[model samples]
Target: MIDPHHAPTGTAYATAPSIVQEICLIAEASGSGPSDVSGDREFRLRKAALLDCIAVQERARYGVAASADADDAAEVAAEWLVEYDVAHSGLSRKGRDLVLAEEYRDYVRAEYEAWSRSQAV
Candidate 1:
């Protein structure tokens, strides 16, 4: 896990929106977005998924023990929030590895399980 950072109380976040915009800009330019972004449905889906992933990552950050490590293993829920040097929060990097790691254990397991089920046919 990256070293957990803590900012002072009542931190101003004038730059947070820009930071989040930067993350979104990267994903948009990175070709990581959905295949069909020309419509509302796909856009909504991605946005919702982003929010959901962030929620899960936030839960993991709060719920995971500070002492947790790869060796300190146990099953727990996860979220996909991407923390940056500003504002201390954002779901700006939707499908990144750090985002995935914050998902604790279930997200990847669920994905693999889904894949396994698909392969069973």
Candidate 2:
């Protein structure tokens, strides 16, 4: 069992998609599967990440609907990421949790940034 929880700090940041994929794979291998079921928080975060990606792809295509969906998705993604970090880290305080989550958050931010930049070009 590769303990994802034991993954080093910043690794999550550098590998958002990989992390997401691993989670999905684990969820699947667990017999329940990601699509079969997940906790509220996990589902919400997954949806947010999905929507956020859709919005970015749409924006790259210059779609008018991208802005609104993207904003909403981004907001939700951040919210879920925070929740996820808190849940996973089990820190005694917000400060410590935030510190732990920062790398992952930055990774998400970078994904969006790269997507946005590509759209510009």
Candidate 3:
């Protein structure tokens, strides 16, 4: 799991806005209730999913585990947010933007799980 507090030196990738944008788009399109992007579960799960998707889509996009990785992960997370169409999209009070971030976390988790499963085989 990528530490929210501690990012890689000289590679601290920050793109929370991208996820915010996706969340807004989703809410705009679906017209549903607020999204469930918050707390530990949401962040961890969605962040994982985002990472996995980025890796599958393209490793080079992340560069390392710093700038590129964070950026790609953010993009994937934002994508999920937009895709989910969670209402009240921009409801993150702490500026963390949990709503959009959660989806990406889920994506990254799924990616690792699949990879782990394959390795077990």
Instruction: Give lDDT per model, in order.
Output: 0.34, 0.47, 0.43
Per-residue lDDT for 63-109 in model 2, tens only? 65646656565556655655664677563335534443334344445
- How much is the lDDT of residue 37 in candidate 3? 39
Ranking by lDDT: 2, 3, 1
Candidate 1's TM-score: 0.25
Q: Which pairs of residues collide in model 1?
A: 53-80, 56-78, 56-79, 57-79, 57-80, 78-103
TM-scores for all predictions: 0.25, 0.38, 0.25
Between candidates 1 and 3, the lDDT winner: 3
Per-residue alpha-carbon lDDT of candidate 3 for residues 10-118, written as tens digits (9 for 90 to 100): 1122222244453454445445446543433344334534444344334344455545655566566555544443343433424434454544454444444554455
Per-residue alpha-carbon lDDT of model 1 for 1-121, expressed as tens digits? 1112332111122112233563484368447565644233223323333333333344455654543442132222222212211123333344434344434333433433343355558
Candidate 2, which segments miss by more than 4 Å at Cα?
Answer: 1-46, 63-66, 91-121
lDDT: worst 10-residue window of model 2: 1-10
Best by lDDT: 2
